[model samples]
Target: MRVALGVSYNGQSYDGWQSQPSGRTVQDQLEKALGKFADQRISTLCAGRTDAGVHGLMQVVHFDTSAERAPYAWVRGTNSFLPRDIAVQWAHVVPDEFHCRASALSRRYAYSLLESPVRPSVDAGRVGWVFQPLDLAAMQAAATRLLGEHDFTSFRASACQALSPVKNLLRIEISRRGAYWRFEFEANAFLHHMIRNIMGCLIVIGQGKQAPEWIDEVLAARSRDAAAPTFSPDGLYFLGPRYDARWGLPDRTPAYDWLP
Candidate 1:
């Protein structure tokens, strides 16, 4: 059986989402947990990869099983094996052809303003809280300019393995809630560190270090260093993927709200 799972985590302690040979990683830990809990040597595929220090509020993944498993078996079993930092939020059986990555139509992500030099009592690991204040209005204006399909060469990591720099940015929204600033985006796909780099540029303007309109110059530069700086990984989150009906998971509830 093919299964889809919802997971969330505090990425501060691991290297990243993908398994790595050198340091600890979310994938490696999950695989180990699967071995212990499911007792089936199960492997999983995620909707997207998040870097070390990045969090996930609603990440998705798929795995295969040799025999039928109950919904709670995946949730309860996986949770039992996983460390406290990672949690299996939910699970459902899915079609064999359904993929956590390839079958996704779009993905959404969010980042935060993590710093405050004046009053620094905030949680240390969630968002990229900067010391200085940010101009939320200006940041939102700049974010709106990033919508649409474009070559994000300027913001992608130099080591990014993606074949193309062009991606369809479906939405880029900015909102402020008291001292917290939110940067949310939805796109067909993203290059490695693309969102972080973009956040870096936005923060520069928010702090009045650069003009909001500088987004155009950064995108046109098509170089990693051209943007402000990669924002701290703490504020980033791999939200989830959206799928079409044809690629539906077998046990997906009508409540899954897979559609927008």
Candidate 2:
């Protein structure tokens, strides 16, 4: 039978979401934990691969199990085996056709910032600690121009292997809540490091380092070099993927294990 698991992780200690030959990864760690509970290897397909040092709040993975286990035990038992930095938030048994990544209709990501003059040493692992105040209004204005369907070559990685650069940006908004500035984005799919790259360019504009109108120019350029440097990985999170309810899950829920 197939089962889907929701996972949350601190990405600092690992290479990325995939299993790597040279370094530790979330998949490697999760498989290690699975050793105590099952005989066969527990291989999971993620909603998407988060780059090195990128955290997650709602990454979904699915694996097969020969022996029946309680749905909730996948959470409690896996949590007991896994390290504190990585956790299993929930699980649901599903049909074999239910995929963690391929079936996703849309994905959401969030970029977080600490906007203040004083450095924040405490949440250094949780957010992009910026000691400069950003112009939230300017950032929001700039983000709007990039909305809608377009070829996002500028923000994609140089080595990005995606066959197509075209992606639909359902919504992109910049909102401020107290000392934190958030860039919320929902899209049909994302190119490699797309959200982080967008945030880096927007940061420059927010800090008066670049003209807000330059965003349109960068998008038009459609070249990786035309965009700003990709932002730090810590501030970004693969929030979750949206799927149809017929896949044996609810349409929406307030609970998220992978919020970054």
Task: Estimate, for each residue in 9-107, the C-alpha lDDT of model 1 and write its tens digit.
Answer: 889999989989963888888888877876768778899999989887777888887757688887898899898999888887878877888988898
Candidate 2 global TM-score: 0.93
**Model 2 accuracy (lDDT, Cα):** 0.83
Task: List TM-score per model, in order.
Answer: 0.91, 0.93
Q: In candidate 2, list every pair of residues with a backbone clash.
A: 56-258, 57-258, 57-259, 58-258
Worst lDDT run of 10 residues, candidate 1, spans 251-260
RMSD of 2: 2.0
Off by over 4 Å in 2: 250-260
Badly placed stretches (over 4 Å) of model 1 are 119-122, 245-260
RMSD in order of candidates = 3.7, 2.0
